[model samples]
Target: MKAIVATELGRGPRGLQYLDVAEPVAGKGEIVVAVRAAGVNFADSLMLAGRYQTRQPLPFSPGLEVAGTVESVGPGVTAFVPGDRVLAIPAFGGYAEKVAVSAERAVAIPADMDFVTAAGFPVAYGTSHLGLWHRARLRAGETLLVLGAAGGVGLTAVELGVLMGARVIAVAKGEAKLAVAKAQGAHHLIDAEVDDLKAAILATGGGVDVIYDPVGGALFEAGLKCANFEARALIIGFASGDVPQIAANRLLVKNVDVLGFWWGAYADKAPAVMADSFRTLIGWWQDGRLKPHVSDTRPLPLAAEALELVLERRSTGKVVITVGD
Candidate 1:
């Protein structure tokens, strides 16, 4: 089977090479999926570099979400059958020709969703959905300030915020990236490069009700001044490679709440929350209210290049590697 393996930490990927490994077969209550596409995420790069929060063993593939057709089903797997189209957040091994995953983790895909888009959904958008509605309890007509709004989860925040009737201000590095965010439904765009983000965000709306921050660093602290009183700040990730430090005085002065939203933890603690999120999100998607703006789709051979885009902070929206159809 063809797959990308991170043989060691800090070493980049090697091109696809032939290996006579036996094909994966379904285990008890498991299903084997013939992967059609895999989504490239920052975690893949961090996992390969031994910097991700959940570290896997060495010499492993690092994709978290995969979409494909069911090739076979193991014993006790009655919920699915061969030839089912599915998307899953696997324990590991998604960046391969085939993956054996627990049937309970595989979500049945709609006939309308493309394999690439399906693979892109479960992690990035799912995180945004759960974080916004469940954690923050984002209210309609409230203002939202989105840091790193051009990236996958950031753009999802923009879309979901707008869907919930919030005034959205997208904060990103370049005009090109901000333009994409505008096209995806951001009400206002703040170019963090040429201008002051805090000023620009506050200039549009008097003060933001919620700040969806995925890029943490000095900018995370700088953006705090734009939050309104009793504001909610969602701490999604540190894509900036620098974890932020918040001063106690600022919290007391602003009277704001800092929330740490860990989407993975909810998969076990509140699995039903994700099911409801998917039903509502996909319903909006099917109704033409929300569409995932995929910016790039690279061939399987260029998987490393796909990861490099995010690692270099040069990405806009979701990036995927097509393994098949």
Candidate 2:
């Protein structure tokens, strides 16, 4: 197997090395997958720097989601067999030619979906879907404001918000990125580089009933000031590198609800919720209501470069790494 191995913490993507490694074997209730594609995420960079909530030991691969073919199945795994095409949330070790994942965490991908799109599907879409429908209880006619609206998870929030019938205001850095958000069905686009975010969001009318914030810092502060009465703000992530400090007074003044969400936690704490989310997401995909935007696809050897694109915010949607044919 060939993998991009992280030699030490805090060394960043530059510390990764693409080299031959021992192939993973399926353990009990696990399946060994010959990876076809892997999704690159901001969490991968955080884990490499030892800053994320979950950390792997030194000298590990950092990839959260992958799409591949099942090469072999372990004992007690009856749902999948060799040659099955599946997508998995491995949490880590997906930037490799092969990965051994528990059967319970893997889902059979639709036959028509490409490996690259399937690789990018689970994390971003899952986070947005669960955050909007389950946690925030977003109403169809409400106004929704999305920060970092052209990035991986942010773009999905824009699309889902529109599908749910909300008037979506997408905030991003530039016109190019804002255009991408608009294509995904954003009703309004605000360039955070030039526009005053609070004013731009308020101009959308009725203020914002729900704020889907993945890029925190100044954007979160602005969103707090612009929130409607009894609004819900979903804290998805802090991609801007500065985690905002929420003022308790703001919540009191507006009767706002700041809801923190982590999609990965549902796998253990509430498996049924996670299962239902995937079912609905796959159904939407089959119906052409959900379109996953994969901005860049690179071969296995350029895995580190793909991660760099995410770290630098150079890619619009999801960046995928192609592992095997």
Candidate 3:
């Protein structure tokens, strides 16, 4: 099989090479998938630079989520068949023609959803849904502020926040990106390049009740200052390359809650919750309520370039690597 192999680390995307590799076979309780498309994430660059939490051995493929057709099923796997279309969450190794994942980690993709959309669905959409609904308990009629609103997970947060009945304030770098957020149903947009986020957020709705931040740094700090009393701030990630040091005084004064969330952890800690969340998301997708924004699509051999698009923040929404026809 052809796969993009990462033979060394600390070299960013340049370390990856498209080369022929041994194919995988389904093991017990697992299924082999003929990958159609793989989702490129910011973490892929982190993993290559050796900054991510999970580290693979010397040689590996770097991808987290993928959508494909089932090629084969191992013993004890009855949930899927050879022709099933599904999305699988392999911890890594999705940048390949085929991958073997535990059946429990895979979900059947909706018949109407294309492989590119399904490839980008799980991590980004799942993160926003879980963070806003489960962690923050965002309510309708409340004000929701989304930082990095043009990015992959950020766009979903903006869309879902509005769908859940909150007035959304989207913060992004420029007008082009802000326009994309507006198309996603954001009620208000803040140009992070010029506007004062704190003032703009406060001006938009006095203060926001729920803050969804995937880009941490100055923006996170600014968003914290504009939080309404007892507001819930969800820390999704530090995409800005700088983690914020929370001020104890700020939390005490506002009685605010800083909720840290990592959607991947739910797959192991609470598989049932993960399953239930997917059921809801899929239903929304089926109804045309959830539209995945894939800004770039690259072929398998150009996997490094695909990762670069995400790392450089040049692409809005999600970037996908098309693995199969």
Write model 2 residue lDDT over 76-114, tens digit each, in one string. 999999999999998689999999998888999989999
Model 1, residue 231: C-alpha shift (Å): 0.9
- List, in order, the clash count of every candidate structure: 0, 0, 0
TM-score of 1: 0.95
lDDT tens digits by residue: candidate 1, 47-81: 77777778888667778889999999999999899
Q: What is the Å distance of residue 247 in model 1 from its true position?
A: 1.2
Estimate the overall C-alpha local distance difference test score of candidate 3: 0.92
Q: Write the per-residue lDDT of candidate 3 for residues 1-325, one digit (tens) a residue.
A: 9999999999888889999999999999999999999999998888888888788997999999999999999999999999999998998999999999999999999788899999999999999998999899999999999999999999999999989999999999888999999999999999987557788778875888998999899999999998889999999999998899998999999999999998988988898988999999999999989878999999999999999988887999999999866
lDDT of each: 0.83, 0.92, 0.92
lDDT of 1: 0.83
TM-score of each: 0.95, 0.98, 0.98
Q: RMSD of model 2, in Å?
A: 0.9
Mark the 10 consecutive residues where model 1 has the least summed lDDT.
12-21
Better of 1 and 2 by TM-score: 2
Q: How far off is residue 246 in model 1, in Å?
A: 1.0
All candidates: CA RMSD in angstroms? 1.8, 0.9, 0.9
